[model samples]
Target: MLSLSDLRQRPLNVLCAGDVERHETTEWANSDDIDVRNRFADLLQRAFHA
Candidate 1:
């Protein structure tokens, strides 16, 4: 986990598992895609500053 102070101290870059075109769907939540799942996790991590 990363603290807010730590996040402010450095740049935070979130990378997708593949091409951007591959993840251009609005479906997330219960999607069965690994890339979508990983992207969702990334979103949560940033939102909670974890």
Candidate 2:
């Protein structure tokens, strides 16, 4: 598991919870979750609007 501090070292816009989870189980490499992509897009939109 990646510590919060490790995740914080990079730009938040390019990282998400799944990236850390992938590091643990390596299953995300085959993930097809559109919801995650939508969430990231939403976050990016919010950041840009702010």
Candidate 3:
């Protein structure tokens, strides 16, 4: 797990909470649930807007 301080030290555009795996492409690698995806989208929006 990454601490707040650790995250603050890096440049992060989006943060998703789930079991993620490395993928060959740039596609999503976490949960496929609609709710999860929606939340992730919201987070991504906030990240960029902030």
Candidate 4:
């Protein structure tokens, strides 16, 4: 069977992509279809810095 060490060896980029996808989904749900995507971008930056 695979060991815990093997799991830890998984690619880091995969984890990052999951986080990015979830963030996009959240922003889309809270935003309107007409406005610019800038607000979402700004919110993400603020959240990261905070």
Candidate 5:
């Protein structure tokens, strides 16, 4: 996610609830509901002016 954001040169807003080495996780990668994607989308949505 951060990689794609860096590629696009955008503001990265990350809301983390725990300490971690890296953000990458199998939880999102192997699930029907993507929590990481949803969180990233939340950041994107708030960044956009309505």
Candidate 6:
């Protein structure tokens, strides 16, 4: 199976993914197609900082 960890090690200029269903965001995620940019941003912030 393919994964971000595998791809992260290769030489690449860009990386992307979609469809994160966070259980905590139930109150604001009124639509399935909604773009949760802030949620991903927060995750990335924590990922890099930690």
The numbered model that scores best in lDDT is 1
- Model 2, TM vs. native: 0.39
Model 3 clash pairs are none
Give residue 35's lDDT in candidate 6 (0 to 100). Answer: 60
Backbone clashes in model 4: 0
Model 3, clash count? Answer: 0
TM-score, predicted candidate 5 vs. hidden true structure: 0.33
* TM-score on alpha carbons, each prediction: 0.42, 0.39, 0.40, 0.32, 0.33, 0.32
Instruction: Write the residue-wise lDDT of candidate 4 on 2-38 in tens digits.
Output: 1112223456444333322223446544666534355
Residue range with the least summed lDDT across 10 consecutive positions in model 2: 21-30
Q: Which 10-residue window in model 6 sums to the lowest lDDT?
A: 1-10
- Write candidate 2's Cα lDDT for 1-50 as tens digits: 33223464467535665544323222332347766556555645676786
Top-scoring candidate (TM-score): 1
lDDT digits (tens) for residues 1-50 of candidate 1:
32223332325323333323323235664688888667776776897874
Model 4 residue 17 distance off true place after TM-score fit, in angstroms: 36
Candidate 5 local lDDT, residue 28: 43
Q: Give the TM-score of candidate 6.
A: 0.32
Provide C-alpha RMSD values for all models, in order.
Answer: 8.3, 8.4, 7.7, 11.5, 7.4, 9.9
Candidate 1 backbone clash number: 0
Pick by TM-score: 1 or 4, better one: 1
Clashes of each: 0, 0, 0, 0, 0, 0
Model 5, poorest ten-residue lDDT window? 1-10
User: Alpha-carbon error at 10 in model 3, in Å?
Assistant: 11
Error of model 1, residue 32, in angstroms: 0.8
Error of 3 at 30 (Å): 5.0
Ranking by TM-score: 1, 3, 2, 5, 4, 6
**Model 1 TM-score, 2 decimals:** 0.42
Query: What's model 6's lDDT at 41?
Result: 51
